[model samples]
Target: MIKKYLSATLVGLSLLAASSSSSAKVIDFEDINFSPSGGFSGQDLTQRYGLNFTGGRYGFSTLTATSYSGWGAHSGNNYAWGDGYNMGIEISGNNITLNSFWVRGALMADDVGSITVRAFKGSKAVASKEFSYTETYHLETFNFAGIDRILITSRGSGPVLLDDIDVGFASPVPEPASYAMLLGGLGLLMLAARRRKSS
Candidate 1:
């Protein structure tokens, strides 16, 4: 009996996870503009900044930017940083979430720094993280209420492209034990139906 209940609960959880509020829907890409400055890349930071379909360094919308793969010096920390693109979004609603995702490099660096996703509440830094360095990409999610602005930045050095900047509402669902309790209550319906048939 417990096995059946657990299976049912898992199915319901998966269903909720696949729902609308659970996923970050793409609103727009705006457009990728060139930013030679404000990055850690070399060659006077001369690299295309706008999003391109063929070579996308960052993919949140239709547009994405590719970076210049070079061992560059990062600002302040002087850490080696890769050349990635910067994306800005207008935050609204009661709550907001920033899901950080990275594209793994085919040729991973020995001393790869880290990718940093910065959460900005109207130009104010709230939270940040250093993503791992490898050929496999990873995703990180954060939750906030009444957010106004957001910015994502890279921490490590070299060239890496990021895609799928998911910013949207996070859905709330009933807990598994709650689900079990609800399902247990549903058994009463079967009892009622049998009574009526016997009568």
Candidate 2:
């Protein structure tokens, strides 16, 4: 019975260590405090979202009864507008791994024609993609590791629609003492099993 309990404890400890190492999160742009009425823009979105930004203004489709799906604004304005003529989200000091975001052409504005999305580690570009939007919005997944910033440039037009930015960060690394404890527990379990076999 003691050996069984020891083995279970070791397994639980392993799982706990793994789960405490990294976290995945999503920013759906649904936390804005706007009433969702007529056209709204010219605000610091990075500040609004508690992030960092460098570029043109960010806005949203005026609040309306009939609009994008799954939005919590006055109406259903689910899209965050970026006069993405030239824009980028800089996540310095806050080391993160950008996962993905949804992008579409800004309605009635300028179709987001072609655009280039790039992920960078400092001044070095790690990943990039040049794609054009169709009639519907698409989720562009970025699989870069330890990226500090992301930039979006309009290849053709100047406006773009964006939503649901996903990012992840590695949790603090465990201290050496944690490893010692884990190994010590396992060693005891092994010793117990060996003694049982001898008996």
Whole-model Cα lDDT of every candidate shown, in order: 0.42, 0.60
**Count of backbone clashes, every candidate in sequence:** 11, 2
Structural similarity to truth (TM-score) of each candidate: 0.37, 0.65
For candidate 1, give the lDDT of residue 117. 51
- Pairs that collide, model 2: 36-63, 37-63
Residue 25 lDDT, candidate 1, scale 0-100: 53
Judging by TM-score against the true structure, name the best candidate. Answer: 2
lDDT, candidate 2, equals: 0.60
lDDT of 2 by residue, 1-199 (tens): 6667677777868876886676777766555555434544333454434456565434322212224333222223444555545544344424577787777655444454776778888899988888886335788887777777777766545456666677787766778787788778777877887799899
lDDT of 1 by residue, 39-85 (tens): 42222122222111221233322222234344221211122123443
